[model samples]
Target: MSRILAILQKEFLQMKRDRLTLGMVFMLPLVQLLLFGYAIQTEVKHISTVVFDQSMSIESRDLLDSFSSSGYFDITGTAKGYAEITKMIDSGKAKAGIIFPPDFAEKLRKGETAPVQVLVDASDSMVSNSAIAVANSIGLLKSQKIIMQKTGVQSLPYDIRVRPWYNPDGITAYYMVPAILGIIVTMTMVMMTSMGIVREREKGTLEQLMVTPVKSYELMIGKVIPYIALGYLQITVALLVGGVVFGVPIRGSILQLYLLTLFFITASLGIGIFISNIARNQMQAFQMSFFVFLPSIMLSGFMFPREAMPSIIQYIGNIFPLTFYLTIIRGIVLKGIGFPYLIPQVMSLLVFSVIMMTLSIIKFKKKIA
Candidate 1:
């Protein structure tokens, strides 16, 4: 216990001495919350669109008004032909092109299904999805309204209503902020711990540590405990900022959320410790951390839905601790759910922590490499 306390004290002192890393520990969460909270929006709007209306009629103008009023399409320029519309989209001047045939208004008057072409740049999937959904919805609604007016019927034969839970207005920040907190903790815990140990090894401080009476497990625990505290600090900052600045609701028990977060923090710290054991220097440690970081962001359901991914990729994502943590944090913060719903995720994190810590202890050498 005394040896562990001494190592813990040594680590705290080292962290204090490294002002830049210490600053980053506090600042990174705030910056990411602000950046991602405001920047990454699922409700895509004001897509730059080019219109080519060959039908010079009041009916065509009204249809254009419908598109503009929907707030999804912003007509910036007009094209004379499909060739010009394609060129604008290719040049990045527009994301969508709405081309109406010469008979668009005539077809509508004759009670025929008007074939107005909508070209969307599918390179950006999110933007494309938004445009496509809105465009299709606009067409459907307009057709329905026309049919209702002609038949003098108030209701359609079938009506489907969607009620979104957690976020009623579909606010992206509300969904993203909680996951961002998990991501921040993961990044700091993994990269900092891995790099810190490798740095100590490079500076010969690890050799000094080897000569001490402290055991390898004691060193690992001491090194990891401080980072666990730092991880909590990061989580606290993210919660405060997310709640106060972004108005993200914490519907569940704050105590339960903090308690369960211990498993995740420890799990991430173990991964870092494991990385430190295998890495020869700080550079290698950083490389390994980066390798882990990519999968966490991409496969952890942070930016995209894992359900949309291939079954093989989904299986690969389960290997990462962040994938489970995302479900836990989002479930707690957004849904306000409790332990019953979280047991599976919590158990998974616990198992991962145990495995990583065991591997790290086995791999950690007391002697100089």
Candidate 2:
């Protein structure tokens, strides 16, 4: 225990002296959390829309007003023909185009189904999907009103009341901020730990410890303890910023969140130590860390939904500890669920921690060979 504490004390002193590393350790996560929390938005709004209304009647204008009033579509300009609409969409001037038929007014007056064509640029899926959904909703609402006026029915027979849970208003921060916390911890644990250890080998400092009587497990513990504290500090700052700046709610038990986060942190650090063990230089360590980090961003449901991915991709996503931690953090922070409901995610992180730590201990050679 004393030897481990000695190693721990040495690490803290070395870190303190390296002012640049200290700055990065604090500032990197803080800056990234603020930037990503503010920058990443899922709900697309104010789509640039072009309309080609051939009818030019009160009926068509009324329908167009509905689309404009919804706050999703902005009628930036009117197009004379389909060619102009297509050109506007292709040149990135407009994301959507609404076209009314020549007989749009006549069909409405004859009590027939008046079809309005909505053209959405499918280049960006997020923008296109929102445009399509909003257009459809506007059409349906208009149709429902017309039918009610004719038939005098109070409500429709089959009305599905949708209740969105967790994030009712679809606030992107509520979804993204908690996941960014996991990303921050993973970045420090995987990249910094591996690079720091590999740098020690480069500078011949790791070999100095070979003459000591310290066990491999003790050294690993020493290396991990300081980083664990740093990770928690990062989390604390992120939580404060997330709540204060973005209005993110911590609905579940704070103690449980802290307790379960240990498994995730250990799992990430084990991966870092294992990477350092395999990498011959800091460059190789960084490359390996990026290999882990990129997937944690893409495949781990950080930027995209895991359920939408193919089964094989989702299976591959499980390899990273971030995948499980995302669920845990999101559950605690947003869904307000406790340990009883988060058993699967917690157990996955626990098993991952055990496996990764065992591998790291086995792979960590005391001698610089």
Candidate 3:
């Protein structure tokens, strides 16, 4: 009993002297809570929409008003022609486009069937599916309202034409593959870097390295760079699997995806280094890595819908680095959106990277006691 107490006392003393590890043990959970709680929303709101109102009549205008008032579609601009609608979708200016035919009002007035065409960019299958469902429901409600006001007879007057672009079937794999790539990178980079340093500590190599003339920053760089290369390798493997096996198409520029992934990888590596600096052994490092990993998978809207979760939990999910990376990768790969549309996610990743790397470097010890 006394011998066990002695060992415990020695371990606690060592932990107390290692401010980095102590701080991490206390701070990581709290920080993760605040971040994931606010950022992990799944329910999509404020979808950008474009309208091509060829009818330009009271009925067409009233129907457009019904859509905009639903709170799902945000009417950003009006398209003058069918070509304009296609352009808006291709340029990533809108997620949905409503085209009213020239005979829409004429047919409605005569009680003849008319089709209202809705074009949706279905590259993001989840978002597109949601938008389509909402649009269809709105159309049904409007038709019912028109019947109730006119002849007091509720009946279906016209069909709402829904055209889903890019992915007609709304395949889950198409949307998930790009996101999985981001997850793969995060898992590899963080786990590899975190375990690498702790393994050195367990092997007694960290003590020897500390006694050398190499500075803390130099050692940190050496530790991180190799893992960055490994991250790229993992990314390559994930992309190949997504493409060749799952048949996920790369609609956007590969260069763009790679560049954005570089940024995300660096951020994840920073987190791993932070974890390694604080963990006393490989077991502790693995525990800490899992702590980060579980939340990332759940909260990042990877496998589950963020909106379906309670608001508080959704917010907690956003703090994981994977959450923002998922958004960036999905936007670029599925939507073909450029930097202008992706600035918010990229900035968040950059901020996280800077803070984590700074904390790790500042808390790093130079002398071996």
Candidate 4:
């Protein structure tokens, strides 16, 4: 009993000296509770939308108003044509596009059913599904209203036509592939760099390297380049597996995917290097990497819906590199979108890479003492 008590005291003393580790130990649980509690929601809302109202009639305008007022969609822009609608969706400018055909009101007024094409960017299945549901409900309610006014009947008279674009069937693979790519990069980049640094420390090579004439920035570059190559290799393997094993189509340019992935790899490697600087041993490095991994998987819209999360948790997720990377990957893979549409995600990734790499370099110390 006395021996155990002495061991516990020694451990506590060690922890007291390592304030970062101690702080992480105490703060992680509380952070997880708050984050998961608010960020793990399944319900999606406030989807951004665009309207291409070719009809320009009272009926078509009323229908558009119905959608905007429903609280599910925020009408952000007005598209001029079908091409513009497609452009908006591809560029991540809008989640859904509501198009009213030229004769929509005429057909409806003539007692003939008119089709309103709802083009949904179904890469994010949760948001797409929610938007489709809301659109259908609005159509049905409007039809019922027309019926009640014309025929004194409360039944629905017209069909609320729905056409989900991009992913017509809403396959889970279509939605998950891009997100899984983000997770893979995060796990491999962080774990490999952390473990590699810790191994160097364990073998006493880190001290030897420090004594060499290599500049700090040069050494950092050398360490990161190899990991960046490894990241590309992992992406290649994962892409192949997704295509062959899961039948997930690569609709966009492979070169674009690789370039975008390069940005993400660097960002992830930056995080790993930062963790390596903080952790003293391999076990500690592994623990710290896991701490980062769990939140990333949960909060970056990888497994859960970001819309369901409280506003604060959603904002917290924006800090992660994966959150932006997922958007780029999904846009390319599922929507066949190019740089014009992917600028925002690319910019976000660039900013993240710059910040993380700068922080890691700044935090890196040249001497063991």
Local lDDT at 322 for model 4: 84
TM-score of each: 0.96, 0.95, 0.58, 0.58
Over the stretch 1-369, how does candidate 1's per-residue lDDT look in tens digits? 888899889889988999998998889999999988998887789999999999978888888899999999999999988889999999999999998899988998999988988999999988999999999998888888998999999877887899999999888899899999889988888998899888889999988878887787787778878988898899999999999999999999999899998888888988898898899999999999999999999999998899999999999999899999899988989999988999999999999999998777666545334
- lDDT of model 1 at residue 195? 91
Candidate 2 residue 341 C-alpha distance from true site, Å: 1.9
Clashing pairs in 2: none
- Write model 2 residue lDDT over 1-369, tens digit each, in one string: 998999899999998999998898788767887778788788788999999999999999999899999999999999999999999999999999999999999999999999999999999999999998999999989999999999999978996889999999988889988998899899889998998889878888778876777786787788878888889998998899889998999999999999999889988988898899889899999999999999999998999999999999999999999999999999999999989988998888888888987776666545334
* Prediction RMSDs, each to the true structure: 1.7, 1.8, 16.7, 16.2
lDDT of each: 0.90, 0.90, 0.77, 0.77
Q: Candidate 4: where is the Cα deviation over 4 Å?
A: 1-155, 366-369
Scored by Cα lDDT, where does model 4 land? 0.77
Quality of model 3 by C-alpha lDDT: 0.77
The CA-based lDDT of model 2 is what?
Answer: 0.90
**How many angstroms is residue 210 displaced in model 2 relative to the true structure, after the best TM-score fit?**
0.9
Per-residue C-alpha lDDT of model 4 across residues 302-368, encoded as one tens digit per residue: 8877999999999999888888888889889998997889888788878887887777666664433
